[model samples]
Target: MKRTLSLILLTIALGACSTQKPANDPALVGTWKGLRTQTDKCQFLSWTTHLKPDGRFTITFFRDVQQTQAIQTEQGTWSAVNGKNELRTDGVRMPDVYTYQLVDADTVRYVSVAAGPSGDCQEDYAFTERRLR
Candidate 1:
């Protein structure tokens, strides 16, 4: 009887040590810098966005070589849907639903998946973002 109890205790300890908490989407309440590496003219475009917990975000696209000038700025509300696998932005021109993939707590990739007319084409805008802090 003692040997059986010891075996059960050992099994329980081993199981506890082998398990880990599952990873989930990180909080979006921070600053993120993103860049698009591919464009039609092969020019690089970068943007910095600040997201607040109140569901508001402000994104400014860089337009200068020094990254000091902004060509445009977008302010809107953003939310994650489909169990945080997708991001929906409202109040932005050309609002798109993107494939939101979080690699870790500090990294994410956004891919535009909206199809064009007839569903034969889709915008290939893809960008990866890193947390500022």
Candidate 2:
């Protein structure tokens, strides 16, 4: 009887544990665009993040406002943290951590942390519109 009771308790605990959903997959697997806004400055930038199934990612940033002008572009490795909700970019010269929240399948919000000449600067409360390929 004691063994059966223990088994039942263990089963209950396992069931409860299994009920906890895994963190949402990092959804930055496609092109994203947003109006890059800073203190009194705003421009349009396009971003592309590719997430491989093998836990690797690549990110690209491009300036899109200038159709005739040469686009400023950069690319680097990326990783998802905090259950694929937060993204960290590697090999960038500025602030590298981005907190990404998916508003929908076609939209995501991100906060970029950057360094300024005076001190550390943070760009928060920003939104990105997903670009359909």
Candidate 3:
């Protein structure tokens, strides 16, 4: 019986080690505004991206630093990848994969990796963002 109990405890310990840390469910169903560091020409873009719970997203770019003048807009969908550590976006001009981490309750840092068709062009962008609402 003692041997059986030890085996059971060992199994339980191994199972515990395989579990992941639980986190509060973060909802991206709102607008997020931030500075996106671009690498194509090395510039910062003022952006407001909208997200929905249904995985739909819209990105708006601003020409002014104050984020008042709208320059362009694009729509896409976002999905979680690599066990939620990364985000994959589709239906956009840049179709990118972004790896991100939460810095705090209201902030997150994201790194997006992009590649061109010829396979010779690749770029990465780092974005510092805050939840707006």
- TM for candidate 1 is 0.62
Summarize candidate 2's per-residue lDDT along 1-133 as a digit string, tens digits.
9999999999999999998645445466655555454444445544555555444555555655432343444444455555234333445444355566777788777665543232123445455656556
Candidate number with greatest lDDT? 1
Residue 48's C-alpha lDDT in candidate 1? 87
lDDT of 2: 0.54
What is the descending TM-score order?
A: 1, 3, 2
lDDT of 1 by residue, 15-106 (tens): 99888433333365689998666455656667888877666678788865456978777676666544343233454344445677777889
lDDT of 3 by residue, 67-109 (tens): 8888778676666544243233444244565667777767777
CA lDDT of each prediction against the hidden true structure: 0.65, 0.54, 0.63
State the TM-score for model 2.
0.50
Collision pairs in model 2: none
Weakest ten-residue segment in model 3 by summed lDDT: 115-124
Off by over 4 Å in 3: 1-25, 37-40, 81-94, 115-122
